[model samples]
Target chain A: MAEKDGDENKVAKQDQLPADKTQTVDSTSGTTQDASHEVQQELVPSDARELEVVDVREGAFGVRGTGDTSGYGGLTRPVMMPGAAQPPFGGWFDEVHDRLQTLTDSHDDRVIEKVVVDRGELTFFIRRHALLEVVTHLRNDDALRFEFCSSISGVHFPHESGRELHVVYHLLSMTHRRRIRLEVTCPDDDPHVPSVVSIYPTADWHERETWDFFGIQFDGHPALTRILMPDDWQGHPQRKDYPLGGIPVEYKGGTIPSPEHRRSYS
Target chain B: MTTVNDPYAGTTESTEGPVFTVTGQDWDSVDASVVEGDRIVVNMGPQHPSTHGVLRLVLEIDGETVRDARPGIGYLHTGIEKNMEFRTWTQGVTFCTRMDYVAPFSNEAAYVAAVEKLLEIEDQVPEKAKIIRVLMLELNRISSHLVCIATGGMEIGALTVMTCGFRDRELILDCFEMISGLRMNHAYFRPGGVAQDLPAGAIEKLHSTVRLLKERLPEYAALCNANPIFKGRLKGVGHLDLAGCLALGLSGPVLRATGYDWDLRRTQPYWGYETYDFDVVTWDEPDAYGRFRVRLEEMWQSLRIVEQATERLAVMEGEPVMVADKKIAWPAQLSVGADGQGNSAEHIRHIMGESMEALIHHFKIVTEGFRVPAGQAYAAIEAPRGEIGCHAVSDGGTRPYRVHFRDPSFVNLQGTSVMSEGGMLSDVIVAIASIDPVMGGVDR
Candidate 1:
């Protein structure tokens, strides 16, 4: 199940870090791989100063061609993401990174995939296989004791192609009085990431919540049942593909459309 | 040996004896299971009064001693996070404010602060606006704690404690209504600042309310602080040490009760909280009684912050509460009209006649809302319950890409099993009340 094909599933493992960190993976190459490939692409930064265009959305209100009576038919915008940060990340972020690196340096491949310092916060993107080890170190290490796992939030980006699901763990170190974010990604087809319940018992329900919403299965979760949704519910309601269910409201003369059917701006 | 055939009970005949398969029948009627072992499973509620807001506890008890306890939530799940994805950034506040109904200001503050951080306008948010936000949040803390004490006291059959708690809480609600124009679910805290400035006579009302609360606050101390029965019911019950709290990721009064002086307001100050003076109330005992004392004392600290804010608000009259940014700040300034509340006449005139550009901006802002740069930021605040954090992701659009709240109640609720297991079945209510998990937040 963990086997990978050449080039197609290269980004899936920690060993295949893009040599040119600024390279962008085309969506077609990542999407065409088989389910067994377990393709996962790390979000590579394109430029140091500019925003990396993740997707180029065309025609406002999701309309294309002559159907768009609204004059925004020709308009297009690039959905951008901030690039990875350079070394010497201001404040204690550098020390945490150095300590985490020192602990995981013996490994064949780097555990820290990419570091993103955005909006006065530090985010460390980690590989799926190394997530448990990294989290345990963060908790047990006296130097970096992120003792409290604040919450686990799952983000499903269908546009990310190979890596369609992302799990972010917000950790708070009360001992050091610092906070850092750890993010791990997995392919939508094989959404199996290691569960950190062994290290942090509080992640029990949070992992359940992430699974309930995004359907990202934690491989070793003792009882990974839906927490906030009914057990018999069909689809993960928070996924981008799932429809926002609502009924149309009827006024005296005309019926007002539901939210999904209403005119959209983006 | 019974003559009547019971259709409800699915019974089958075996060589040794007649086996009864329990299906939708009364659990007490299942004698075969009781014979196998002394332990019996009981479902407390998705509807019981003491469970507090649709939280169902599945308890496996052996002769009134709980062998195991598991919480069954999601009965109150409203999918507010999913709903916020479809709405504009400014409109997202309304959805999140309703998450923890008791402390709506904390929800709004965390969300709005996160949005401002994503916008990189955290510093640009007016000083007066931060003060008001802090003031409203402190007031909300008092109200939320009052409800916790009131409902917690009611669960233990203390009628007077419940009545007095609510009575004092009503005064705080009046202050909230006087300023935000609503008693609860006040979507007053916006992205740039608050929805509007403090209304006329709001200061006087706050002063009077604060004075009255100070007078009546001691009633709770006199009533429950030394009462032997209250002490008997709460002391040493739901005991979770500092290690247990750290492992389970508990915070607020629950963690503070363990004698840890960790508070987001003190440790990681936001919205100029470091400038204020207040103690992080804590207790050495890690139990229901300790949590109760922590909450009771935290209310006094919150009142101190509230009083300081009221003094600052009196002098900073006529200062702009919203940010100066034309692109981000809300376009309309509301006023009380002859009919009801409506857009200010000056703003209306400026948009209608003064400039066409202003008119376009007004239309654009009101209809589509302002856009935030693409990125994600997590803003955590010390809410009345615990650490309430908002993780907001934007795709450089008017609508949010994804928004998730790390509601303290939700995380703290995970400790129910750990706290209640191996204890008397009666103490389950005390354990839950001490954690104070708001189902609205837990199931959001």
Candidate 2:
């Protein structure tokens, strides 16, 4: 089991790199490709080229000698965590962003760190304190009316420092037929975000699930117990650092390494 | 006074009168006040067959009336969402399809839709592919509802209905096998389009099954709907009004049964569903019987959609099913060989002996898989149970960064406490059966 407390500064290292550098796929897949040595190529810069490769994890490929004969086994995949999007944010995204801005009066309203519009969906990376208020306004505002709390999902990014753990909320407006995502990050040390059960009772199990899998705690939840895994299980399985823990399987006088330890192109 | 399988006919069966420390029942820390006033606490199965796949209910009752109900879940957690992180984007479909074993197509659709949205190829997808997706999902809805009524009818002690329901469900499965080779868990819908076009005469096979289901629905209505015992058990047993449905995030039949027109297919139209003409079936009675009526009516609506899709697909033959872009698509060109469904022989020959570039293209796609740009998307669809949503995040790699399913079963499980609180213990089973939760979806 790793330390539940994640450092806040770890994720800041992502912004230091220049935004335009191209990332190589590398020989992530490691089997027969060793002889072929697939040449590195630059990804075509379309609308997606603007996103930066902020962080890369160690051991991008699986462990060696696990029978990973697929030449792509040495694949060390570098994750591209993109930077914040600029203004004029297109379509209904601009209206949602501008409307929420008027509702809040905080002088230091750095609630929205980045505005990312990708694949026709808008994601607001909000500060932890603004979650409850912003959600309440979204539900009550006649213009927004995001009455439905669709889902609350947990995502763990081990290499992205400080803001290592993310709790994502998918909110829907039945009246407007629009959906927006709200993501809040908490460091490993204080993985606590105020519970929104009072506002949206449906968030109860989702919060429990996020806690069960990512170990990010919701401070005021009624019952903060594990919902999916056994009550007394040890570590959060969904975290990237956690191993999948599968032994190689033997079949018909041949052996195949578990996906956990297989070599892949990185 | 009751000697009919009443093991405690002579002796009393109350907390104060006698103690029964059953191995499965556990309500140790309940309030002391409820312990008095002729109350009894019984723990009903993480393994009990009628509870619908490993769900355990802790019920506190006074005589036959339930005072409080607490649900204990997680017996069937396969950690499927976690396992998806290890596999490729296309392979994630296999794991996701297994989550809601009852409605595997809807599960597959939700996951793959998110992947397509991330790739930003949503609009460029071929028209015929969208039609096939609609065809498969509607067929899946019918089969899933059949299982629902079949098992629910059996749980309420109607053995004949169970036999009929499962028997009819097999026909739907037969059509499914014709399309994707597998009867259940068919990962038919790939990111860009379907894995391949419809097989020869597959539409005719679907037409026959659709005709059969349309005819047999009325027979089902007469046998189970009009039966007084069936009505007595389900009519007002698990009553949930519009308020309860809205607060609990309930959708599909349960919400529709409350006279709320909240079907996602009608309201949030996906995959050209808006182009089709169909009613969003609703019922005045929000109870177990109401859900049954809503399900039966929805089956007819599904039949209508399937009939329409089959007609469109007949004209759409020879059109492309996979995307024109080669980067996102798989290398295999699916075809029905003599033995079973497999890759095309012509395409195989071209790659092997005809062209070296074709062989290299095939190798690259097969080896690395496809890459999706860095972003996140949430896609939801109307499943048999309720609204099933998939939240997919890509790190611009061949594999998915993170994926989570907002299973309708998990959200609706909380309602067991609300509905069964003041109802009879027998009605508790009826109420749970009406919810029609698949534990595989709930725990995953």
Candidate 3:
């Protein structure tokens, strides 16, 4: 531990280099590229020319890369890959991706709705009814082995046409420092999703919280109790339709209703 | 009382029925009323001092042992998350800072980082601002850990340790007051940059305090760790193995205690944490004692980072802490009234008479705040407790579409039951305290 601290200290001290030494933008090119890479390659692709390797030391490298194609605006400087050789849990992301591909290939087109890749993390949007089967495949499939449910959070999209409530499940592979998000959406009136507590006992409270805030019921949860909000609290507090506050105090002859009391005409 | 099929039975026969019983019973008249066993329930707190806050635990006791313990939260809920929806983007900082009052800077930094991510303006944050943030956050981490150590000690019957912990923590709060102008919930960290630059003498004070803490920490460790009673009370109590912690999404020292080395600062760097040198302290014991030791060691590591960060701040003496982007950062040197409030008579007159464009722009920005492009982003930071993440969604509007905080205390608190389930009832207090949950952060 002390050795690690010492190495980090050395790196931090080296990082105190003058800002000018790290500056990449040149007046001539009007673009920033790795100064060290200029000698190794010639005529870099116009699109890829914006990639600037900010720092390169030891096994780690920081690159300021642009993502214009994915509609991801602005320059993103992801610390591409850490210095560690093995992904925290060996081959975590790779196994999940391969398993997901195999499952999607065998499943019906409607069962596997969409797959969106945001940066390195993958999100699979399956049909609400297929959530149980998909999650089961991910958990039980020897190759996939997404044994842990990192989080289960609910998102409300009021303006969306069909599915207004999105239940997002974050899965992590402890053996591999890999993560994937599983999203399933259902209409606001009937927000029911199959519970994963049967597979992972840790999902008990997370599912309860989702139920508490978004009013999404997880079938087969042992105790679907309110984890955060009061047991008798009215409505789903996180829903866009729910008002922010309900405290109302009338002073003198005038009356002032809290934010909750104000009617949502829409 | 009636006993059956036992050698040393109190009474073999009853007295109310047509049977012969003990000394007081008449022949042919005996009563047999067997006592049924039912579980006794005890409510531990919504106001109990030992509960740490308004936390209530309903325990089902079978004799002297606890059969089931259910935690009841939300007594301290203030609806801060819901309130964030009604405020402007910049105004949300004031609310987020209150969530983790012990380490307000972490909450502020996480919230602002999320906003900056949505705006895609993180890189544009000035160098000085990053250093200032690291400085404030490390100091906050130490202060927060001190509170945990103190309160945890108090919970474990170490009264003197509490005094030492609180006394050391006050020094950090004094530093906070100097920099942010408030002891707690300062709202010092804003979207584009810090609310203001570090005050004069803040670095000098931090240097002396860090040195003092480094010297004094060993005494604290000796006081708590070396004592036989303290060790006996904590050593093997409330053990949550590595698998249990990982399954429950535990982070910070609690997770580290279980032999997992996961620190967002090292794994996923932010706020120029990549430029700081520190260790992700860990222990394999995975017990209450292990957690206590990890937090104590973490304080020393935090002090090291503070020393180094303070040196870096000294180098960037007078650099602009706020971003140069006028669209994001408010202009410096705004004229103030005698009451020290902005929008004074002179300021408004100058803006209206001299720079009508500035007046119009200020009015528009102040009224609506800056609009973030429609997108979603999740930014995580290492708070004193664990991984504090902000998942923000924007719909190309001044108001955020959705803002959800993955508070570490909340996630870490989930592992409490896993830690205490099979342990003794007395172990429950140590287990809960080891997690060091601030209910404000959890229930936010």
Candidate 4:
């Protein structure tokens, strides 16, 4: 039986933008189209300068660079930042959200932040410290039995100051054939998050890997050593700030630029 | 042995001749002393001939029994995920294909599917492309499982099965080479569809390969099914029950062997797999033998799917293999010719000799990959080893913001310690063989 929680059980389905239309400028094409086009249709950009003026998203979005042989010169795509999804979460998403919200409210109040329903998948922005409690509840609650923690992946948002490192947990519910993502963030300088290995033992190696590539330390992981990078390697390679340069290979008449030297969309 | 000078032993003297403590007569005694007295730790290799590929295992052993087995990996870390961030979305396929090294098609399928989902173009991709994808995936499953069986057989000291498995696997690879012009790392699957349509005569070749596999698969069972030596080494060894599998996030045949019928192809049903008629094979023993049986039976199921796909493919000719939308698909059409494969001469002449717009369009799509709407999608396929997933995040950029793979080998390998901890030293190899951890997938 699901517990009765007053306001916590409310799945806040705010009126969201139409699910299909996202405002991403097609940098490849020179034209822009209004949202009236079919959901999948993309319009070419109108200006040729649009391909070179990528600096507009500087410091706010993905990397920007110059001098690339690849076609994208000035095009910049603006990614939507994570926010709360308006309610009537639709299909199984509303149920999963309410169950988690109620369960977390009864168990711990500091678990979730923003609930995003994008691409028909539900994502819970969880606080760094309450990961274990949240995961345990999600796995144990009969209605929300997300029995499998499918994977633990880390993403670094350089623009998101104070919370630059985000660790994502993709959980699967075999009983209901549902999937949910739990995202927790920590600052780049202090990237320490509580280990969810206690709830999902599968997170052991994955947590170690996150530590290896992104330098996010799992507070209670048994052995938080590097899994992919060598043990003595210094910097986490997957971080956005980490340079991509490698040993430059010599080809016939051309000096191939190392990734750091090559013009990338910084 | 001690009577000899032995100056080369007991020190780091690479400048001198290699260390040679063993004299002809002293070899047996040295082996005797280790087994009879002291506990010795064995380092299995960053290069062992059993063909797991660049994995090193340190087993602390007390005589013939292993006290503990610690895996030291990352010898094959290629920074593939990092490299993907630098390339356009389309080029990411080439890099991901090389990660698993074995199940190239599965990696491509998962990555492409994630990108398709992120771009919100899943429904728009041509139906012909989906059927071809299904065909390639099932065929890839057969080929990858064959390699697993081959290498697994060799690791367990069964030479005949290894030979038969590899020999049969070549039939599939040859078929792949004919279709995609490469056997192993076929970057055949692209974002919208495959890189190109199946080559001429590919259907007949695939049909022959399928028939040949049907005849050869049972020979493997006959050789190992009832053999006492084979069963003795595998049965009741490396026991990972359903609980162990679920706790560790293990999937594919390993979970199937534990009697959990959780194949993603059936449960989640990506790539129209739900429409296909096949049973999810499972076994209840939950041991090395169980995994072995599960893998064999799964191969049969893959073959069944492949046969069905080919039958449909035969009927569906002249259908577009790529998406209908011009922007999402690659610009140039490639054709196989007298010298291997390359861009079509006719398309090249058309762009160069006449149309300025066609040339510019080609330039833009080639240089900057198509932008995916900013969001994230986790697309998983039941790979030969287990659940291979691609978690793709696009920043509305031509390149991916981040791409992470839930490589099944990496997850299933957590069961290594659980399986080998209490077992005998020799069973360690059997356990590893059953888990079938591809080091490329593990270290990537």
Q: Estimate each model's TM-score.
A: 0.90, 0.87, 0.77, 0.85
Residue A252 shift from truth in candidate 3, angstroms: 16
Candidate 2 per-residue lDDT over residues A1-266, each given as its tens digit = 12222212422443443443233222222212221232322332223223434465434354555666666454544465554565677778888898888887542336665667766778887778778888999888999998878899788876556677889999988888899999888777678888888788889888999999999989889887788887668889899888888889999989988876664533
Candidate 3 residue pairs in clash (backbone atoms < 3 Å): A89-A175, A89-A176, A89-A177, B15-B30, B15-B31, B16-B30, B16-B31, B17-B30, B17-B31
For residue B340, model 3's alpha carbon misses the true position, in angstroms, by: 5.8
Alpha-carbon local distance difference test for all models: 0.86, 0.81, 0.71, 0.79
Model 4 chain A: ten consecutive residues of lowest lDDT = A46-55
Residue B216: error of model 2 in Å?
0.6
Q: Pick the candidate with the highest lDDT.
A: 1
The best candidate in terms of DockQ: 1
Error of 2 at A99 (Å): 2.6
True contacts kept of 1: 0.87
Score chain A of model 2 by TM-score against the reference chain A: 0.76
Per-residue lDDT of A142-227 in model 3, one digit per residue for the tens? 66767656667888875442466888887765445456778777766677888888776767777888888889988888878788
lDDT value, residue A116 of candidate 1 = 83
Flag the better candidate by TM-score, 2 or 3. Answer: 2
Better of 1 and 4 by TM-score: 1
Q: TM-score of the second chain in each model?
A: 0.93, 0.92, 0.88, 0.90
lDDT, ranked from best to worst = 1, 2, 4, 3
Cα lDDT of model 4 by residue, B77-156, tens digit: 99899999989899999899988888889889999999999988899888878888888888888878878878888888
lDDT tens digits, residues A1-266, model 1? 22222124333321232333323433324322232332333342232322344555777875657677667886756566664666678789889998998888733235776788888889998888888889989999999999999989899877665677889999999989888999888878999999999999999999999999999999888888788887667789999999998999999989988876766676
What is the alpha-carbon lDDT for the whole of candidate 3? 0.71
Which portions of model 4 miss their true places by more than 4 Å? A1-79, A106-109, A247-252, B1-39
Residue B233 displacement (Å), model 3: 1.0
The complex in candidate 3 yields a DockQ of: 0.14
